[model samples]
Target: MTDIHPTAIVETGAAIGENVRVGPYSTVGPNVRLADNVVLESHVVVAGHTEVGAGTHIFPFASIGHKPQDLKYAGEETRLLIGKNNQIREHVTMNPGTSGGGGLTRVGDNGLFMMGSHVGHDCKVGNFAILANNATLAGHVELADHVILGGLSAVRQWTRIGTGAIVGGMTGVEFDVIPFGSVIGDRARLAGLNLIGLKRKEFPREQIHALRAAYRDLFDTEDGTLRARAEAVAETAADQPLVKMVTDFILEKDDRRFCTPRSGE
Candidate 1:
């Protein structure tokens, strides 16, 4: 018993589950699958080989499952898979994967994509993440669980945002963001531990304290050798969750160096 607006155009080959609502002037293309309780607001377009999970709501003028805007993209069979209970706000554009990038763009459950946000080709967004208004993630980016991108922030291609990290507004991030840390500004320097976010997530006090200590040790250094700092923190603070997060961040760094502390601190 789906409720489809008369102005909406749903192709016969599209698979729509029960209790779905298609608003006026929306379009659903062939090979698109809308699961139970999904709602597409007016002027929304669900195209290509896209699959919308149950209980997901897409707001007005949002575009999902469009082909990659990459120049390297050929006419390959890419797919976009969105999980359940996601709220995609107005004017958001989520693009599918490119043939060069394995052809899959995936988003996990309970995520919030705010108005005017853009997710580029082959991006993998984890559960419970929040992309604030005008937040943009480039191709091949990965957002771990509970990451928060503030308004007007843009992440460069292939960058990874670690779990529980908070990216400040108007920042341009070109490197990986450490887990449980806060980043701000164009060069995206590490501000401090995301204490407020940790508290909201119900992280233990001991863990938070240990993370604060680790942050001090890492950033308070003269030369800021993250490897040396991480090793030192691991030896003493290994039992703490925050210490483990810092250790993992140091180990996972590929080519770029971690954000260093400001001088005279």
Candidate 2:
């Protein structure tokens, strides 16, 4: 029940599901698995222990599930897991995890990875994330759902971007970004809330209003500590899921510094 081109090479032990379409000159390695309705355009290379979930479409020349590009990597078996309904565009490169940083690079559902984007080793990309053209995430970065990385943006290793945050084009993120935060500039700094994104997602007006108020109290006001402010806001906005997400992100224990607003803002 699959449509595979004669030029395509489906290696032995590869598991391809019903309604899958393999195009010209593509290669599916022995350890690869493609679920139902998956489409691999011409010249795609899916190697290693990679699994393409159902309803995903991969464009031409993507090299996925390849060996990690770490000098310390020593042939340890690792895996790349892509979720359903993802649109992986041309020339994107996603590497598996390295032994030093766990053994799996996982991407969640409904992601849009544009041309030339790269997900480095051991990254965990959440659902509904968007990586614009040439966006790059260094090893061990974590992107929460609804996060958007603008074209040419690069995130440093060990950084985490919380849900609904957006990093502007050409920015370099060296620290963790808060939920719903919008940032721009070469060395990215917090730039208020992602108002447009919140609106587009149709978040309830009351929730949005509460989030805005919380943002001000957490960042604008001189608080005892970020965690303390987050907890206070969480207590007040107990019914708001978005508020909890923001507080939870703030409370996450990580070595990386938190991204803050520029001076004189």
TM-score: model 2 vs. ground truth: 0.95
Global CA lDDT computed for model 1: 0.89
The residue ranges of model 1 lying beyond 4 angstroms of the native Cα positions read none
Cα-based lDDT at residue 37, candidate 2: 99
Model 1 misses residue 127 by how many Å? 1.0
Off by over 4 Å in 2: 254-256
| Alpha-carbon lDDT, every model | 0.89, 0.93
lDDT of candidate 1 over 21-117, digit per residue (tens): 9999999999899999999999999999999999999999999998888999878999999999999999999999988777999999999999999
